[model samples]
Target: MSAYVSVLPQKIPRQIAGSKSLASMLPTMLSTGVITLVATAVMRLLWLGFSNDFFGAWMEAWLTTWPIAFPVAYMLRPMLNHVSRSMSQPVVPIALPVRQGLMVSDIPHAAAEATRIAGLQVKSLSASRY
Candidate 1:
């Protein structure tokens, strides 16, 4: 109805200006998950349909090896977008942890100092260490 159309813009602006919205991102995430699931399912069904030992072995190997492809595609997407935007090549994202020694115990003081330095109000810090 006209009421829904009129209220939609107030809900979602044309430009979020570097902000992310769950409403917009959720569909993308869902589609990605669904595509991954469906592709795997279809490939599996096709592989299972073959009765020959050689083809069955091949299909089994293919299904087992398929997980490695997703990480490559996921890593490439940002790079491809940047490549399209400008001449800069995509940088590889390392899946390493940031710092080994820092944990939740170290967070309170650093967070408090950071808040103080940033001129933000300091609140009580509560933490539990195992």
Candidate 2:
């Protein structure tokens, strides 16, 4: 019996060198790549409807936009993450007095009164349950 030879290479060269920094950037790189790919294709389609040149135009646009998008997205990722975290948390509503017929001097008193009224309302609500 003749021995079978595999066509595939035994060792594949690493495309990207793995490191701590690269690991940190991997998520941003992947997300930016996917977002830019879809956005560029969609925008190109919208601007110039399906044609024989559509694929070429879309590829060109994606190539141009991705370089710019990746750096901007990487830089803004921290701030955006912070904003997203802040937005996702539960928000506590503060009672504020309506501005109608209220003077600057009465602002403090009005706020205090609003808080007092709010506390009373809460107490009443809890009391009603019993």
Candidate lDDT scores, in order, read: 0.62, 0.85
TM-score of each: 0.30, 0.54
lDDT of 2 at 107: 85
Candidate with best TM-score: 2
Name the runs in model 2 displaced over 4 angstroms. Answer: 1-17, 92-130
lDDT of 1 by residue, 1-130 (tens): 4555444545556453654654455445555556666665566668566455645665565555545554555557678778888866556568965576877888888988998899998565667632
TM-score, candidate 2, is 0.54
lDDT tens per residue, model 2, 23-82? 678888899889989998999899999999999999999899888998898899899999
Model 1, CA-based lDDT: 0.62
